[model samples]
Target: MLLKELVDTAATVAATRSRLTKVEALADLLRRLPADEIAPAVGFLVGRARQGRVGVGWRQLSSVMGEPADAPTLTVADLDALLDRLLTTAGSGSAALRSTALRDLTSRATADEQDFVGRVLIGEMRTGALEGVLLDAVARAADAPGDAVRRAAMLTGDLGETARLALVDGPDAVAAVGLQVGRPVLPMLASTAADPASALEVTGEASVEWKLDGARIQVHRRGDDVHVYTRSLADITHRVPEVVDVVRSLAVDDVILDGETLSLDEDGAPRPFQDTMSRFGADAPRETLLRPWFFDVLHVDGRDLLDEPLSARLAELERVAAEHRIPGEVTADPAVAERVSREALAAGHEGIVVKGVDAPYAAGRRGKSWVKVKPVHTYDLVVLACEWGSGRRQGWLSNLHLGALDPQGEYGEPGGYVMVGKTFKGLTDELLRWQTEHFQSIETRRTAHVVHVEPTTVVEIALDGVQRSSRYPGGIALRFARVKGYRDDKRPQDADTVGALRALLPGA
Candidate 1:
């Protein structure tokens, strides 16, 4: 199919708020695509490249200028092949070569197609539909159950390939997709509750495990061969050899373990979240070592435990890798849940995750089968600035720039606010209108995208925790932060200090 046809379909999907309409439009587009073109088309429509990050930065894309074609000629396969070539050319003069390639490719696309291609290349193709909606659309187009498509996508770890299978080879082929020993399956996620007792109430009989403040890893092992992936399913086996070695040493010949990994201090306590990230994010190994703690086993001894309940999976995990299992116990009593939560918090860990004993794994989703209970930390922070909104939020100041007071002037002037993070979540339309009108009164300066305001307005912000960072002046960044409400009664001096924010850092 022509690139313009896909681009037009994407526009239609974005224009509709009704999910059914979006699914119909996408399904129609998928039906028109050739079997070989289905995977690339699905990837492109979902704002992803089939080959992952193509090493093409914004600078390279913007550097090459090409005139739009008057007719539709670029096919989905054509662009995919062009990207494949671009990925191969590297080293000296590779930039010029890539630029030429991009120019040649763009010159063949019409104006709308060019816009779509540019957005796809830069990772800016934000339509309402992503993987979830597209997965449903694939099922609709193939006349298959949604669960079948979801399971195939999760097990294979590739929605694009799953789309091709469902559209081309039929439902029987989609059902055939299963766990491979060395390929990571999507990690199951948890929804949040107020506390352990509250979570246990929701899950009935449950296992309360210590929720560590670290990276989530899915390890797949087949004898000596082992592969590790992040929560987002990016392969990081090269960066974490120790993890690979540990998985390889497991008694089971083939197993897929879902767990957490973090660095521990000399005292055996978990290191700061940043310290673990410092090692995990590095291209080369750091002095800090990562220890794996398994909570659930997806596959064991070539038997798939993903369809099995949590209790069965835990039993399998104990028999296989009991030495590496996370601390927890199974109980229906809320009192027991509370005690476990206390133990987890006292150990300097984040909190407890109460999981249903009878619940099977629900991968690629945050379902109610499990609930995470963590203490909420709220602070009164000063408003540093606000940024212009986009799409539905246009004409309103949507994203807030939050800063913590620095009383000691450790990172800035005494009594001045130091930048910490930005958040656009938990804001209502009324709140946006209020911000746009109120912030302008204290405006110190203005830019195309942002309005600098006097750090006088204090707002109540709630965050999960803080992580060490070089991006902020205070050397820490807020995690999962959102506005609770404007603290109109509070002054800038009454705002929380940077030290107070840093104190929330886990294992700090």
Candidate 2:
């Protein structure tokens, strides 16, 4: 199929607010794609390239200046092939070669296609073809059960591959996708609650576990081989040999465990989050030994427990890795839940997560079955732009223009971010210097004082609460907002939404 065809379909999807309309448009488009183009087309619609991070930054992309093709001729496969070439083009002078190739490709694309390609390359495609809507569209196009498609996608951790399987190989092939011992599945997420008592009200007879302020890790072990994946499912096994050793020592031959890992000081207190992430993101493991603490087990031996209740999974978790199990208590009493929360907080952990004892594992879904409570109001928000610093902090990016995701376009474009507030507080000189260099690398455009960037960086912000205001497009601004840190583990799409922020309004 032509790239224009996909671009036009994305436009159609973006022009409407009804999810049904978006799904129908994307389904129609998906039905017409050839087998070879299914994955690439899905990736383009979702604003992710098949070749992740092709070394083409905004600077390189802006360097390409050429006239667009008058007519539609570029195919989806052609664009995918070009991205593949760009991914593999690395060495001295590789930048020049990649730029030349990008120019050649853009020169052949029409104006709309150029814009679409640029957005896709920079991870800014906001056509409302969200993964959830696109998954529904894939099911619609394939005439498969939506639940089955969703389950397959969650199990495989690859929507593009799931789309290809469902569309090309039929629903049976999609159904055949199952939990692999080596591959990583999407980690389950939790909703936020005011406190453990509030969370327990939502989840009766709950397991209140410590909410650690550390990196999320998913460990999959088969025989002696172990793999560690981050929240986004990127493998960091080589960077965390300590975690590998822990997983390998588990009693079970094959298992899938979800937990957190962090560096601890001599006092057994968790190190600063940045310290852990710095070691986590390193190319080689450092002397800081990360200890693993398993909270839930999804698979054991040859049996899959994803469909099992939390009680059952925790039983299995305790049986195999009791020593590594995160501290928690299973109770229906609100007082006990509060005690656990207090204990967790007193121990320097974040707070507690109250999980329903009867709820099955809902991978990639943030439903009310699990709720987290912390004393401070913290949110993961996107950095929309950065202001040039002044005075003593001159020449650095100091103030951050923060935005919350607006999935339904209630205040702006669908799937785009609505600016909530700005903050120059809580940033150390190191962060200011780092962001000054980093933001420019991903900078989309700039003014004399502000540098606008692609909405991609995710930063954790602590706030007193949100107050209604007309100063921003979202009609709510973060009160007393300050940066906790940059969440290198989160993606822009994973940031909290505008609705979530509005839910914090007084009497809400």
Candidate 3:
């Protein structure tokens, strides 16, 4: 298929707010894709290239700008091959060589194709074709069940592969996809509530577990071999030997466990989140040991428990990994839920997560079946832009322009962020210095006083609440907002949404 067709469809999807229209447009495009181009086309439409990162940055991309081609001739396969070359390019003068290749590719693309390729390279699709919407489109194009497509996508952790199976191989092939022990599946996510009582109200007869402020890890063990993955499903087995050792010690021969890991001080208190992430991001195991705590079991022996209730999974978790189970209790009483929340806070943990006892694991989906409760209002927001500091803090990036996700384009572009507010508070001098350097590396454009960057960096922000305001496009502004820290573990899509912030309005 021609690149222009895909780009045109993406433009149509991004130009509207109606999800059904976006899905129909995408489905029509998907129906026309040949078997060979399905994967790359899906990846491009979703804004995530199959070749993860090709070592291309804003500086490299900017240096290779050129005039565009007049007519469309590039094919999807041609673009895929170009990405392959960029991914494999390396060594002493590889940077210059890669730039030459990028220039050649861009010189052949039209204006619209150039814009689409640039956005895809920078990891900003901004097309309303989010994974959910695209999954529905795939189902529509294949005339398959939506649930089957969703389940296959969740189990395989690859939307491109799922699309191929649904559109080419048939619905039977898509439904045949199941949980594999070694392959990492998409982890289930949670919604938020004000407190444990409120969370319990949503999830009756719940398991209220400690919500630790640590890095999320998924451990898969078969025999003595174990692989650890981050929340984004990047393999980090070699960096966390301690976690591997813990998983290896389990009695079961094969298991899949979902949990958190963090370094602890001498008194058994969890260390600062940054300290833990620093170790977690290292290529090799550091001196600081990270301890793993298992909360839910997805697979044990040869049976997959993802379709089972939480109560059944907990029983299996207790039986196999009892020593490493996170602290929690199964209760329906609100007072007990509150007690667990208090205990978690006292232990220097975040708060509690109330999970419905009867709900099956809904992988890769965030719903009310599991609700997180924290005493303070904290949200993960994207850094849209940063302002140049002044006075004593001159020459540094101080004020941060924060944005919340708008998945449905209710306020603006679909799958884009809505600016909520700005903040210069809670940033130490060290943080300011770091951001000034970091933001420049990813800078997209700049003004005299502000440096606009790619909307990828995620920072946790604490706020009193939100109030109705005409100052921002989202119809609400943050109150008393301050940075808690940068969340290196999360992606821009994982940030809280504008609707989530609006939910904090008075009498909402």
CA displacement after TM-score superposition, residue 237 of candidate 1 (Å) = 1.7
TM-score of 2: 0.99
Q: What are the lDDT scores of the predictions, listed in order?
A: 0.82, 0.92, 0.91
Candidate 3, position 236, lDDT: 87
Clashing pairs in 3: none
Instruction: For candidate 1, write residues 1-508 as lDDT tens digits.
Output: 8888889998887766667888899999998999999988888876567876576644566567478899999998888898788878899999788888999998898989888887677554555555778999999999988999999998887889999999999999998888887777777767667677778878999999999877788998887888888876778888888898888888878888999998988888888665676665548646888999999998887698888999999999999999999999999888888889899988889789999999999877667889888787667798989999999999999899999977545686544579999999989887899899987765657899999875667887889889999999999999999987775334455577798788667764
State in Å the error of residue 88, model 2: 0.6
Error of 3 at 461 (Å): 1.2
Candidate 2 lDDT, 58-108, residue by residue in tens: 878878948889998999998999999998998999978988899999999
The ten-residue window of minimal lDDT in model 1 covers 485-494
- The segments of candidate 1 whose C-alpha lies over 4 angstroms from its true place after superposition are 377-508
The candidate with the higher TM-score, 1 or 3, is 3
TM-score of each: 0.77, 0.99, 0.98
The reply for model 2, stretches above 4 Å from the true place, is: none
Pull out the clashing pairs in model 2: none
Clashing pairs in 1: none
